[model samples]
Target: MSKCPRCFVSLTSDHFAWTQASGTTTEADPVASAYHGGQVLSRKIVELRRPVDAHAGWAPPPQHAELELGGPVREVCPTCHYVLVDGWRNAQVTCIAMAGARATGKTVYIAVLIKQLQLLGESWGAVVEPFDSTTEATYRDHYETPLYEARGILEATPAAHTGNPYQREPLIFSLGHWNNVSQILVIRDVAGEDLENPENARAPWLQFFAHADGVLFMFDPLKVESVTNQLHDLVPTQERVGGDPRTVLRTVLGIIGLGTPNLAIILSKFDALQSLQSVEGSDWSRIMSNPGAAFSRDFSLRSAPYHDGDGQLLNQEVRSLLKKLDATPMVMSVDQPHTGRPLPNRYFAVSALGESPVGDRLHASGITPFRCLDPVRWVLATRSVWHWQ
Candidate 1:
């Protein structure tokens, strides 16, 4: 069964609600507002359910919305009230949620991830594109333009309560077909302010992370006092530094509760750490220059499959690196989650820009992503989908 792309909730064929598809005035919908964490204004809603002991098989009265109260109707999720896309019921959906503190390079990573996915899709003879109009427009305006075209830094994602926030909708992409079934990828981005507040924990709105197919928690190396002190003269000054990643991680884990989503603790902007190799005579230099370490190489683009051997190597290497970076508390939280049921998790390192920006502009060299796809592919491989040929 496919899940609702917006809410990541499992969909059922049993019964669903529908609203006029056209010529209807939008009004406040409390049910959707609850799931959205804000006021959701939409068309009037109507529900249809199968009668008990109806028959061996049952279907909606009509696939089309001719029996509409005001106009043609479309199906919606009974839980979140999200509209179901055409042929959505036939596809398999994978939901991924992005979580991290502010300035963690998440927006930069996303801008590059789509392009990489499209390039990979072409090589494998698979069609990959935005699944909906909102995704197309949002990606182009907010994500694609600033980083790729303007060659500048992206601003912090606006809070969810702000006017016209783009992150409210999920970025859904059609990954063509895999395993003889339609493959849909849904990525949801959240504002760091919301999660960093701590007050937001245990709130119903963040339930998406708990229910996600995978939740990626990104840690910023720049936030580490030791890393910053060592590289202060080597790298450009950071304009904005987010709150402690540990606090945000705890809040996110609190939201995830006991839900067993695969957690990927990604080390973002790892190029900054790699630059430590030049800090001669330091412990980081010796560690980063190991030559045999998995972090020393980039095999993400070359490999068609997500090899477990390589992934586990990188995972262990990152775990050790985190300890050195003073992130032991972050590691222990995942290793022994207070939820009592420790979730399946792995560590990954990704350099979205490959090089730090020179002020607001990108480095003179063109953008290059280092192992940005590793975390995503790790999640996909678990679902047995999109093993590139």
Candidate 2:
């Protein structure tokens, strides 16, 4: 048995739809035998383990539609032709879609997030790697090289179908094996510009959000005046780029159109807030000074390993933090449904670069991510997948 990458359903040899090579049905290969425990698994085991059918060619019965909270199937995977929806997969992929106005650190966060995950995965004895040539090439040119190698913020991700469409490619990581089964993680990064552009909402490229397992909605705190005003004395003022977060967020939810993916509302570029702790006579100065608080701590350099308890506590703290930042309404809209359906939601704060760069160049410390793994780990834990020892 194998699983659908889009929806973690087990595909048995009997049930897997096969297309004949050379366009001859007689020449089609039998479904590949999958290893289970020790002996090969039966087709019954695969069918019984199937999670949900949300791929392009598969259709869920009418009862499933009602259980899915009246959400719409927004897109089909161009490669697998999988119709993307909630409960599509049993393996549980953490699909965190990046969304914000331009230059809100969406690209930078992605660059850092991957490195952070690579480090975190090591503790579980899993070696994360790109699933294919497409994943490797896209991650290198768009994400890995510019930040990790050249030590600069990544150039804005090019739009889909342009000279560069790497962000559109999924970055897949192998999570070793668990319970005699191998686990894989797939992450997709999207351009903030595409999310912000009103015209792009209806465009095909933006359709991924509707099928994502999770979305990390980034809100830049630098866009707030009170925070920026206080920062001038300590840190140089940043050039304001990007549209209003509220506007972009609303458009994103609209584009998703009632799809029930877990929403991870994130505060990006949190280094500026960290800087406030040392400043005198400021409200933010006192807030960040609390040594016992989760935000005051750094997991990148600390002994803490990623998991649920601490993560859930941090999630609550971040939601409260966002509320204080006056982003409660935006958070509520994604979580508190007007149509009487509540979506699974979490909140996170991340600093892609430990410190802000003077211009396009990175700070001397390079990129040290903070709380970058929260969204992905939360999604993974939900599936109870474990890396091999």
Candidate 3:
């Protein structure tokens, strides 16, 4: 069975459910509201569970028990009540949850990642597109427009508890097909405010992190005082920043508990660090100046098999760079998770926008992403998807 595109929960055969696709009988649904972290007024939602006395292959009818209900009914996840996409069961899903503190450029990374993904797919005779209207509209209105059209930084993603948040749903995309199985990619963006406090770990909505295919844990280089001091002259003052990332990672890891998911520890806004290459006499300059280093340049010319040789090099290089930036604790947290269940992991460095925005506008040179695909490709490579083996 495939998983729910929104919540990342496996669509188990034990329970089946459907909700009225569209109905005038909207009411506050406490079950849906509880999973959403806010009130969710839903249509007539219905569910069924297997009876203990039923045979091994016993199954409920394709539709809800109340047959004469509505014009159309759609399947909904029994756990989170998110409407399932058509053919959700037959397709393979790659669900990734985005984790980061405030001002970590999570939105910006997503805005650019989609574009890069499209271009990469086009080169390899594949198509990547929004799976549903929700994805297309959300990407266009929330992610694509502000950055590509307006050429400005995206607003911080509002918390789920906020009124009518569009971010409550995952960004689902169809990645053509790999190995002849339709591949779906779902990205869940968690507001930094939601994950900032450890107490939020107890919230039911956070269960997705425990079940996601992978978690992209973004770490802002500028968060470190020493690094910020060095780049003071290069980039403008950051308007907003969040609490300690170490605390946020702990909260995320805590929520995951014993669940294991590939963890992509990303160094976000790496252009700030790349700028240090011009510092002439500093250690950062020398480190960033190594032309042969995997962090020095992008290998965008090739389609993967994920380039594991280079990936390994980049992993080691990023681990070393994190230590230099005084973020060893964050690395150790993932390496030796408090849950005592260490997830398969990798370290990555990416600059969604090639240069820091001189205030609200993107760099004058234009958006030249640096290895933004590393994390996503790493996840996809595991599935033997677009990166054909």
Candidate 4:
């Protein structure tokens, strides 16, 4: 069964609702109104009865005889009332939620990740495009223009309650049809401020994490004072830093509760750590200098599919690196989670900008992503959509 992009809730035959696009507008849908923070005009929401037999078919059950049928109708999630995309029920979706403290490079990672996904799709003779107009406009205005065209860092993603919280909408992309089904990718970026505070953990809007397919929780190395202190002399100091990662991780787990989404503990701003290879006599320098280490190179651009051997090596390397950065508590919690529902977890490191930004401006070297596709590929691979060659 496919899941709603906004709510991440499963859409079974028993749970289906829809609205017709007649020339009349009624009261706004409560869920849609809250999500978009505005009125969503449409006909009254009509709940469909579940089919009597399991083997009947996938189409919605016959509409009520009394309902007026004039124009096209759009299927919507019965729970959230958000309109489902055309042919969504027949499509396969991979829903991923982005979690991290402020300045962990979530916004920048997304901008670079989409471009890289397009390139990856080309390798498989497929096309990747935004699934909807909202995704395209949001990506272009909020994420792409500032970072790529203006050559500056993107403004922090606003919290859901803030005025103009564009992050509330999921960025949906169509990856063409694979395996006789339309493959879609849905990504939801959460503001760090929301995850850092305990109060927001219980907010109704934050419930999507409970059903997400994968949660990419980023841990910023730059947030660690020791790492920053070491790089003070070598690289320009980053002005913005997030709260304690341990606290943020705890908050994320609290929100997740018992959900079984795959957890990816990502180390963001890895370029800063990579720069430590030049710090003479330092243990980091020695560790990063190893020519054979998987973390030292990125082979994602190669024609071969994602290498499990390389990913496993990098996972071990990053797990140990997290320990070196004093993230032992976070690692221990993932192994023995407080929620008592252990999730399939992995360690990943990415450098979206390829180099540290000088203040608000990007590095002169331009954007060079490292291992940005690993997490998503891992999720898709499990479904047999994309696999290692």
**Sort order, TM-score high to low:** 1, 3, 4, 2
Estimate every model's Cα lDDT from 0 to 1.
0.87, 0.63, 0.86, 0.84
User: lDDT by residue for model 3 over 1-389, one digit each (tens)?
Assistant: 37886668888879877888776888898878777777878887778899889898887865454584555888888988887866788898989999998789888899899999898888877799999998999999999999999988888888887865777888999889877889888998888988898999888888889899889999999898988888898887787888789989999998888877789999999999999888879998999989999998787536656787888899999999999988999889888877676899999999999888888787799899999998989988886767756
How far out, in Å, is residue 1 in model 3?
4.7
Question: Candidate 1 residues 1-389, lDDT tens each?
Answer: 58887788888767778877876489999888888878988888888777787786777677534565556777788878998877788998999999999899888888999988888778788888999999999999999999999888888898888977788889999999997899999999988888898888866667888889899999999999999999999989788888888899999999888787899999999999999999999999999889999998887775379877989999999999999999999999989888778888999999989998988889988798899888888888888887754
Say which prediction, candidate 1 or candidate 2, comes out ahead on lDDT.
1
- Per-residue CA lDDT of candidate 4, range 1-389, in tens? 58899888888877667777554667766677654444556577777766677565655545551253445677888877888877788888889999989889899999998998899889888798999999999999988999999999999888877888888889999988877788888999988998889877776577788888889999999888788888899889988888778888888888889888888899988899999999999999999899999988887766466777788898999999999999999999899888776888889988888898898899899998888888887777666665643
Any idea what lDDT model 4 has? 0.84
Models ranked on lDDT: 1, 3, 4, 2
> What is the model-wide C-alpha lDDT for candidate 2?
0.63
**Tens-digit lDDT string for candidate 2 (78-163):** 23333333323434344556678777887777677767766766766667677557667877887889888988667876665466
The candidate maximizing lDDT is 1
Query: Which of candidates 3 and 4 reaches a greater lDDT?
Result: 3
TM-score leader:
1
